[model samples]
Target: MDLKDRKRTTRQRLFRSFCCAWAGLTLVVRHEQNMKFHLLAAAAAVICGFVFSIPLFHWMILVVIIGGMLALEVMNTAVERVVDMITEDYHPAAEKAKDIAAAAVLVYSAAAVVIGILIFYEPVMSRLFS
Candidate 1:
């Protein structure tokens, strides 16, 4: 109601939001183990962007591909975990679901690889040749 109370409430809300975000990130990292690898790849892409002085557009594409792949992998991991939790024992439908989720990650990974090669190959090769 008062200015002081409003400021206090706003600070509390901001703290709560930060806590929630940290918790969510922890959950994703713990539950989706593959996230570590995706994160490593993203880090590598970022490093490459800086090292090569890639064009803005090229860097944008790299960021998008890396982000998209990581996002898809996270979703796939979540789906697989839920499905496994529902049915611990092997089942035909469960296998199909898990396989499909894995395939999605694989597809995204392949695309990311292609994009990486396209963006960096020339710069890399010229460095090597020189």
Candidate 2:
């Protein structure tokens, strides 16, 4: 291909990447209700990070835990949706599968909560106590 053609192809590729990113963002926005609580928690953590001037390591841990919990919640929601679609009526096996997926999200959420409390409680308590 000529140089001009190569440049055009590169521009097209970049445009496609940008479009894909926007689409993914749109999907996240559309599914906000499924993960609203986790998003709220993440927002709270970010605000607290700025308010407390948390160190990099603490922020890193918070980010990892929050990301994991959000990912798990999203996966759980997907699994539940698929299961429901496959079996519209109530069934023991479907219930068990849905319960398992929910439990995974709950476990990650609990872990994230504990990490948040540990990371923020000291700063919060000092502010309140002193």
Candidate 3:
């Protein structure tokens, strides 16, 4: 192919990738209640940061926590879907794969919540007790 044609093909490929990603997100949102909850929690965290006037570093930490949890959730969903596709029948290994994926999301989410509490404790306590 000519250079111009190659460039056009590359652009088309990139666009298709983005479209697929968007479709995946839509599928997850439609089927995963946890994703909706996570998004709500993330919004709440951002609002809390604004309300308490958290510093840039704190905001960055929150961003990491929020992004990490959401990413993990998406990964967990992907793993579960793959496992399901492999076997509609019950299988121990498939169960284990799904369970492990879920556990990772749970573990990370729990840690994120604890860290958020720790970071916001003083500010929240003072605001409430003052």
Q: Once all C-alphas are superposed, what RMSD does model 2 give against the true structure?
A: 5.7
> lDDT tens digits, residues 10-80, model 1?
77867777886668668887766688888888998899889888999998898789778877876787788
For each of the candidates, give the backbone clash count. Answer: 0, 0, 0
Compute each candidate's TM-score over C-alphas: 0.79, 0.77, 0.90
Winner by TM-score: 3
Ranking by lDDT: 3, 1, 2
Model 3, span 24-117: residue lDDT tens: 9898888899999999999999999999888899989999999999889999999999999999999999999999999999999999999899
lDDT of 2: 0.82
- Model 1 lDDT vs. the true structure? 0.84
User: Where is model 1 more than 4 Å wrong at Cα?
Assistant: 1-22
Instruction: Judging by TM-score, tell me the better candidate of 2 and 3.
Output: 3
Clashing pairs for model 3 are none
Candidate number that wins on lDDT, 1 or 2:
1
Q: Candidate 2's residue-wise lDDT over 1-130, tens digit each? A: 3355456677786777788666754676577575777788799899999998889999899889977877787678778889989999999999999999989988887778888889999999998899
